[model samples]
Target: MRLNNSKKAKFFYFLSSLILMTLFLGAAFFVLEQYRFYILGWKSVLLIIIPALLALIFIFSGRQIFEYDSDGEALNFRNRNVLTFFNKPVRDEFPKYKLLQYEFVNILIFKRLYITISSKKNNLIILKYDVSYLTGKELKDLKFSLSKVIKANQEREKNS
Candidate 1:
């Protein structure tokens, strides 16, 4: 199974851009008014601050784009931010037999996936991915796929 949240990421970017543009325009208007009246009022400050805060929240929450692929013998995962210039993308690939455990964590509006795998040197490596924008169905599917792999690994271990 291969899954990517390109659509959701695009929509999120669009909404964030809209909010940011609104914040900038509102700030500009406030600045113009302030220049004319020389009056600093609480309401005006809030009018600018509220939208700016909202924009920041939206940008931070929707930064990551998640992708999962499990077609071959190895499982592949990619996590990249919407702002490509800021940070490097994270990519992980390990054979199915290397998977040790998987976990999902939900904190308020954020959702994360954690996977532990065994390295060639017999060390454990943990990888984390942001899955906040994935729909309920998509999340369920991903969980099911990972669970199948873990089960297979357990059975193989028992036989060995």
Candidate 2:
């Protein structure tokens, strides 16, 4: 199964970048004009450059969403970064039957679904959206499918 973002969701990301860019440019102008004499230090340049680059990247790169695919043996997680720090792709094989599961819990105090992969030890992927919008049957079906994955992994480990 695949999950794709709706049109509204895509548009919201674009709208957010526009707002942030406006605020960032306003601050940049203030620093360059009003406080240039006092804050002419290297620290000022460092701060401004970092945020400006971040804003530019966000404006250019639309929001990235994660979806799972089961064709290949390994789990794939992809994201872009400011620096190419982790250039090598992760190729280690996790337990064969591990499944991604989500629990509607307070993930670090926020009301988001805590998504994790369950094996002998739980490998947390990340906090996803809340379960408030999901129907009862949808939630049940999702949980059931995920449990099967966990069960398969456990069996594989036992045989090994």
Candidate 3:
């Protein structure tokens, strides 16, 4: 199964970026008109460059999709960094046979789920979002599916 960012999450992201863009444009206008600033020096260049980069980041993130994919045998996850053109995806994959276990957990009072892919490696964490509660249900469903995969694999091995 695949899980993508929810509509409400995307709406919040879009709205937040829209507000930030408006603020940056407003600041640029104020600096140019009220103070008669020009992008001629390092300081002026910084003012223009920094806000522009920040605006771009906000816009890019707003357009981004956080996706999670899992099958019986392997799990893959990555962010579709939408504005990053020509960027190759760095997909993280964990095979079922190596999976140890999983649990809903908290550390330092932060709530999240962790799936142990291997004892030698760090657990794959379900990323948290304050605006979304759907992840909890999804992760549990994924865990259920993965368990079935492991059991089936074991049965096939025994019958062989």
Candidate 4:
């Protein structure tokens, strides 16, 4: 049974990437037709082929490597099949507190010391060991929620 309610996870970059890929494909075709002889050379092939292959990968899969589980018994997860490259878990510390809500953002639990991409749901995408994930807006939303949770914790502490 799923604990967190599923909602449409916003991947803001999807449209931009689609547009970019479309443009690149158009340009590549145009180049092939207009400058066909020039593009056949090694240098042109290297410049266009590598990025095109990468773009195709991105277009098909999207960019994500981890999933977020705020309510799970285990607060963090690393895929066993994935080769460990960072030499450290993404979060700065093991997340403490019941995670109420999370959007695409950078999460810093006080105890842990590695950065992590906040997961939205099961199948969308999960980013792992990714330092460059999260946007400014997502970060702001997360900070606001975290501040509220911290304040509530402080109040409970004082009362007890």
Best by lDDT: 1
Per-candidate local distance difference test: 0.83, 0.47, 0.54, 0.40
1-160: candidate 3 lDDT, tens digit per residue: 7666645456655655675676687568657854675545445555556666666545433224445676556766564433355244445676656655555554432334455554345545443221123356765675676576567657766899
Q: Model 1: clashing residue pairs?
A: none
Error of 2 at 84 (Å): 11
Tens digit of lDDT per residue, candidate 1, span 23-120?
Answer: 99889878876777656665667668888888667655644688999998999999887767646788888799999999999887778898999999
In model 3, which runs have C-alpha deviations exceeding 4 angstroms?
A: 6-20, 32-64, 85-89, 101-115, 119-160
Q: Sorted on TM-score, highest at the top, how do the candidates line up?
A: 1, 3, 2, 4
TM-score-superior candidate, 1 or 4? 1
TM-score of each: 0.88, 0.37, 0.44, 0.34
The 10 consecutive residues of candidate 1 with the worst lDDT sum are 55-64
Winning candidate number (TM-score): 1
lDDT of 2 by residue, 1-160 (tens): 3222232445545655665676587567657855665554555565456666666644444223323333356543322222233232222234335545546653332233455655565645453443332345645554565566667666877999
Between prediction 3 and prediction 4, the one with superior lDDT is 3
For candidate 1, the TM-score is 0.88
Query: Which prediction has more favorable lDDT, 1 or 2?
Result: 1
